[model samples]
Target: MSQIIIDQLTHAQKVRILYKTILRLHRGLPEELRDLGDKYARDEFRRHLQCSPMEAQLFMTEWAKYAVTITSQLGLKGKAMGTIGGELDSNTVEMLKEDQVIQLYELMLAAKGLEGDTITAKDIHNSK
Candidate 1:
């Protein structure tokens, strides 16, 4: 049953999984090295765009091994960007709410005709 399910995945699905794993690994890297790692991964995947199915399968196999090794080495475990239930932390949630409040306040002021060019400039200055 499991083997049948695995066999049913298309090549594109496998590639997407490999790509997302690489990106998650990249996220765990140090800030200074993140860009370099991301660029390398992106370039490598892009370079292989023209590969035959056998070649692509071989490439994905190698990358899957690499992803496992990198995850173990870096102690990275969690969902990647496209995974389900990717919720923000509490601090981020609060910050987003605060931003929404400010935007709503500005909108209210605009709707009331209280925000002309001069008033808008004053509001912006005061908000800062």
Candidate 2:
């Protein structure tokens, strides 16, 4: 749907659409990522259930972008399995708040099936 039409939707309506869209798009993902993506999307949405209106707007916008991005990648001709989206660029990472960066790091670990492993400032420093 067009941006204008989407903008006309109520918050709840938008939420339902985007939430279903993301989960549905996950069906096109490789098996491992599909499971992880489904859980992550559900957790994120549930966590934001009572967020402020401004926060809700930002949340929806980002997820909307993710939907568009993944849809395009999945639509590619003869796309390889297990290859979907690429890594976040440095500039994007630089724009994230500390908590978001930490969440991103934890997500990376989870995606690698390395649960319970945590990073520290020392580890980050040593990696440089």
Candidate 3:
């Protein structure tokens, strides 16, 4: 049977959980691309792949472009800003099911107050 995640979190727990998951998705990219994604993001890469340097340099540049687009579209900011997504900010994830983690990320984005354009994990954590 398939499991539905995110059925286990509180409203506050949901946003943070989602942000961490998305950030992980971003960190999974190749090193070169990951670096670029950290700087510029993925969408930017699509527009300027030629401007990128050859080999690893080119990889980082292009990948950054990809990272940016993904983060922006996903409503992620800061470390979450580029291709690498965002950082994990909570311990609650271990308590939830795997699918719940995914759902939490989506819900965080879908939540009304959580839809701001500049929310970062640090900001969320520091506020507490």
Against the hidden reference, what TM-scores do the models get?
0.53, 0.83, 0.23
Quantify all predictions' global Cα lDDT against the true fold: 0.63, 0.84, 0.46
Provide C-alpha RMSD values for all models, in order: 17.3, 2.7, 19.0
Write one digit per residue (lDDT tens) for candidate 1, span 76-126: 254233321123365643544444445545544554546542334455445
Question: Who wins the lDDT comparison?
Answer: 2
Q: Which candidate is the best by TM-score?
A: 2
| Model 2, C-alpha of 2: deviation from truth (Å) | 6.4
RMSD of 2: 2.7
Question: Model 2 over residues 1-128: C-alpha lDDT tens digits?
Answer: 89999789898998999999998888887788899999999999999999999999899899999998888788554343456788777788778776777778788898999979988877554533
User: Which should have the higher TM-score, number 1 or number 3?
Assistant: 1
Winner on TM-score between 2 and 3 is 2
| Poorest lDDT segment (10 consecutive residues) of candidate 2 | 75-84
Query: Candidate 2, 66: how far from true, in Å?
Result: 0.3
User: Per-residue lDDT tens digits of candidate 3, residues 18-74?
Assistant: 334444655655555455334432343344435533443444543445444565644
* Candidate structures ordered by TM-score, highest first: 2, 1, 3
What would the TM-score be for candidate 2 when compared with the true structure?
0.83
Worst-scoring 10-residue span by lDDT in model 3: 76-85
Residue 117 C-alpha lDDT in model 3: 49
